[model samples]
Target: MFEQEDALLTIDELCSILMIGRNTAYRLLNSDAIKAFRIGRCWKIPKAAVRDFLEASHTVL
Candidate 1:
């Protein structure tokens, strides 16, 4: 889903990729599960983190 290596996804971009709302995105950001950082008041997520989150999302019942 990500086209660039070493590219950072903005909060909006992350939300779009995750197909989630702003509040939920922020909630995830606040949580420890997501790998993210901030740049002058904006949240920046690495491209690889998308894959990591997706991979971690699945579990055996």
Candidate 2:
């Protein structure tokens, strides 16, 4: 079960959490690398999706 604190977040919230610019966030969303849901005109992203994106995009040097 997911906690309330771990619930889906809005684009702005995700941007703040990821410390990325709005354009970058929008690009990520557009590319579908970060899963998002459209609610009317706003986009919402689950916390788990963010974690998954970070994991999937991680590169080992």
lDDT (CA) for every model shown? 0.83, 0.85
Q: Give a tens-digit lDDT track for model 2, residues 1-61.
A: 2356757888788888789999999999999999888889899898899888887878531
| Model 2: residues with Cα > 4 Å off, grouped in runs | 1-6
lDDT of 1 by residue, 1-61 (tens): 5866758898888888899999999998889567889989999888777778778886521
Shift in Å, residue 21, candidate 2: 0.5
Distance from true location, Cα of 56 in model 1, Å: 0.4
Q: How well does model 1 score by local distance difference test?
A: 0.83
Q: When superposed on Cα atoms, how far off is each prediction in RMSD?
A: 1.7, 2.9
TM-score of each model, in listed order: 0.83, 0.82
